[model samples]
Target: MEITLVEGDITAQRVDAIVNAANSSLLGGGGVDGAIHRKGGPAILEECRALRASRYRDGLPIGQAVATTGGNLPARWVIHTVGPVFSSGEDRSVLLRDCYANSLQVADVLAASSVAFPLISAGVYGWPVEDAVRQALTVLNAVDPAHVTEARLVLFGADTYTVAERVAAGFS
Candidate 1:
């Protein structure tokens, strides 16, 4: 896919799908999750609540992803994927990597031509910003361009934006 670094809020990006840096529970929490919930309104949470009541697991399997409506955001859909917490150890790297992979897979299945991604595992999840940016780019590079035409890494801060730009520079 064509990976690009853009400074903005992932929650407000107008893509076909936006990857949500969600906790395993998929319940609305802090950071990107909270922002998405806040913007998407209560309907998103209600949907999550109902989904949680069904067959949802507290811990999503690594490399797995699920879809939800955007609620109030401009995007049509939100793809929630669980990233490993910092405490999950070095193996968390692979899980973090899967966070991107599974998200793209979900986008492909949804026939999304474009998608936005936040630096999963970076904020409340405690992944180092630089490392997380690198991991995100690595996963993006592996995605088939045909499946996804455009991919934007939306950053809320200048530092995160710099990291994304640095990673994108290498990719380009």
Candidate 2:
């Protein structure tokens, strides 16, 4: 797959699938999760509620992904994945990496050719931006998806984008 770093709103990205860095509740909290929910409209939430009532009664597990309609957003599907909170006492990097991997897996299952992702866990969840970039790139670089041809890491700010660009350079 072709991986790129984009400094912009993830919600604005025109792609087949957009990954949401969601809370376990899948109900929409803050940061990228809130943005996607608000912009995508009520259809997204309706699906989430159904998922909760049926399969995800206990809420989405960290690092696992599920799909919902993009609603008003440009993308056809929204892949929701819960990211692990950053912890200094224990290494949770595997969970973070799983978020990207599982999201891509879900996207491929949907036959999505392109995907856009936010830096999962880097905002309110307290993960450092640099490490988040590294984890995201690690999965995006290694995954050989059957349908996904492009993956864009959409950074919300210039500083975050710069960090992603620097980390992505090492992958080259």
**RMSD to the hidden true structure, all candidates:** 1.9, 0.7
Taking the tens digit of each residue's C-alpha lDDT, what string does model 2 give over 59-140? 9999999999999999999999999999999999999999999999999999999999999999999999989999998888
Instruction: Summarize candidate 1's per-residue lDDT along 6-46 as a digit string, tens digits.
Output: 88889879899999888778888899988998999888888
For every model in order, what is the number of clashing pairs? 0, 0
Which ranges of candidate 1 are over 4 A from the true structure?
Answer: 57-59, 87-89
lDDT of 1 at 3: 82
Worst 10 residues of 1 by lDDT: 55-64
Per-residue lDDT for 66 in model 1? 85
For residue 154, give model 2's deviation from the true position in Å.
Answer: 0.3
TM-score computed on alpha carbons, candidate 1: 0.91
